[model samples]
Target chain A: MSSTLLNQVAFYLLSAIAILGALGVVFLKSPVRAALALVANFFTLGLIYFMLGNQMIGISQIMVYAGAIMVLFLFVIMILKDQTPEEDKSLFQDRRFIFGLLSAIVICGLIWALVINPTMQSFGGEMDRSYGSPQAIGRSFFTTYVWPFEIISILLLVGIVGSIMLAKRKF
Target chain B: MNTFLNLPLAGAVYEDIPLGHFLTLSLAMFALGSIGVLIRKNPVIVFMCIELMLNAVNLSFLAFAAYPNSHVQANNAFESAMAGQAMVIVVMAIAAAEVAVGLGIIMAIFRYRNNVDVDDMNTMRG
Candidate 1:
């Protein structure tokens, strides 16, 4: 097969895995299992990003999301171990079920918008090959988008301090 | 070798994968995240779902950036594409911060109540 066919197959496979992983995140009984499912989802998304030619973001997605964020989630889950009862019936009851149905409707509406709307068709061809390179992204970050980069550093600092303070034993 | 490989001689190209397909996938993921947020009582799971939603939006951003119209000049292609990637980076950082603060809050609540159910923690139920 040609390269385009390969890419199409890869896209479909990755998307299927992503959607399945998302479902697992919602439906899995064990919190840890759910977290693991999310990790799978993130990894698939990273692969999708790579397929889209955004290698930097793809790698960062793996590093920050699948690596760091997942660890944090698992750590929190471990700390809160065995808190929820196994047979909680409240999960499937009134408000939750109603909201689930509502979200299903919202998803259907979005699908209609995606499929039936002619204006939403693909507009442009493939991007420049270097568009997602680390060097290109770095240049943008350091020059035109430097302000936001610095702000993110500050935000991370605040997050670190705030997390420590919040998790402290005493005020 | 050609017969064994069984490759398609000609058919749909990568361009045939419309922009709307990406958007549709993103939206479906976002909707799933929303439903997860609404249904799941565990704050950590809810937070994970929120991250899923963020990733979905990031995918859409990258999709748009890859479109041809995203660049006005060939020389400025990198600059144009950088717009979406830059936003994705900022959003990722913000997401990290949000997760940190959110989990911290959850930890604090768990420390006090010894449970992590959102439904039970109605201390400020005014």
Candidate 2:
């Protein structure tokens, strides 16, 4: 029971950080500052993943989002070197804001009706202690998902080749 | 009065925190991301918002994997978890590939234009 209380505290704290960082990513004008906030958000999410007992995925989240994807974003932002792009002071002036608001409302209603209203089955089952471990995830990847795993490699390769083609200057 | 207090966390098993809290967190993050994508003009920031949205989805997947519903193949809960974890692995790969291809496109645009704004890039608008 005490452990459950600890989990709740940690979860709330991480959630707060994640949400704040997300807000920073959205509202901050400077791309570099926004990217840094996003890094913080990703790290908090990774910690949450660890708290949830997904050790392997927590590691993956850190390595992939904070390390690789963020680097790509920072590199692009540096290349662009734009400090701030838009000058509109009022968010209401942006026509797209209304659409975003509408979509959010629609999504909220749908989720409430579909997911929250339903009597969900409580997660009463014992947590599978060994399932989320790195070795276990790796084993399943190589065994059950081996062929499908190759598809990721193929996708990455295609991304690499296509990016090179698209980015290369016409000489 | 006690029941009212338990209403929000009604069916929680309490071995850990309620899964509903996680789902709510995911929903909030996704909503924020969508708003950011729509309201923000910076292309790079828009990309970050999309990443946030994807991360939110990942959070829900992990939530389910960590605390799978008792009703889902109770005898084989481990298998269901494996499935969720596998899907998350797939999502991560997709996100990585997307970033690679996406940032490359952005760089290409940077090479072409002195300033990049979503409102201005309408060459293919139908």
Candidate 3:
């Protein structure tokens, strides 16, 4: 059906953009550029989330990550002024980079062998009406996940306090 | 058919995307993130790579939640599926907290030294 074709087209296009953004994040020379690339990647990922039918999460991905978190990253990167050192040109010249590439290959291979084949055969059925709406997630949060919810709130508070302490001049 | 177009586009695509595709995308992103983590030396860049890894995992979690296991009991399906979304929410919260504390640590370190390179952080090795 044309609908399925449309879906595939959209997905592949987004995937391509997402991958490019990710690569840009890794390979770009400047910290600001890398952070900008990450922002692109996050935005693309949010769209993919929307395509997956979790509207609530998609919004969260954009707002929390692309909006707030990236801004924080930018602020720090600006303050620190991190740029690629000129002498460190050619990523291939570094032993650690080669080792890193090999390690990445091995890790991907292991995951594929262990996790991918046995499961992920195929998925079926359409998304239910209101599958991942805020209403549904909220309902689950207050009832089934209430304890974790409260714990996370406390964790956030602790994080705020700890960061303030770390930022102070003397401990 | 007119009726097909009348159906929400998300519903049509929703029924057809195999779980494998989502997982593959997630895996690729995770690999990219790992590479970034390994090769990048800047601490802030390293932190961004970690965020990449986290988002990759979040994609997988959402995929699984969207297309749950075929074998799950009917009555528990909603509950189980909801759990995955809930986990993703928890992860986002944790990531936010982590960024706060982590950036603060990095800033504190930068204050101690003129410039911050993670390699210079080996003073603890002494």
After superposing candidate 2 on the true structure, give the runs of residues whose Cα lies further than 4 Å from its correct spot.
A117-121, B1-14, B73-75
Pairs of residues at least 3 apart in sequence or in different chains that clash in candidate 1: none
Error of 3 at A4 (Å): 0.5
Stretches of candidate 1 exceeding 4 Å from the true structure: A85-87, A90-93, A107-116, A169-171, B1-16, B70-77
Interface RMSD of each: 3.9, 4.6, 2.2
Model 2, B1-126: lDDT tens digits are 455433322123236567777877888888889899888988889999999999999998877777766677754777777888898989999999898888877777767777678888999999
lDDT against the true structure, each candidate: 0.80, 0.81, 0.82
- In model 2, the clashing pairs are none
Best by DockQ: 3
- Across residues B21-60, which tens digit of lDDT does each residue of candidate 1 receive? 7777887788888888888877788889999899888988
Docking class of 3: medium
Task: State which candidate has the highest lDDT.
Answer: 3
Candidate 3, position B28, lDDT: 85
Which prediction has more favorable lDDT, 2 or 3? 3
Looking at model 2 chain A, report the run of 10 residues with the lowest lDDT sum. Answer: A116-125
Question: What is candidate 1's lDDT per residue for A1-171, written digit by digit as tens?
Answer: 666767688788889999999999987879999999999999998987877678889999999999999999999888788885352566667676687868688766966666525436536544466778889898888999999999999999999999888877573
Candidate 2 similarity to native, TM-score? 0.89
Worst 10 residues of 1 chain B by lDDT: B5-14
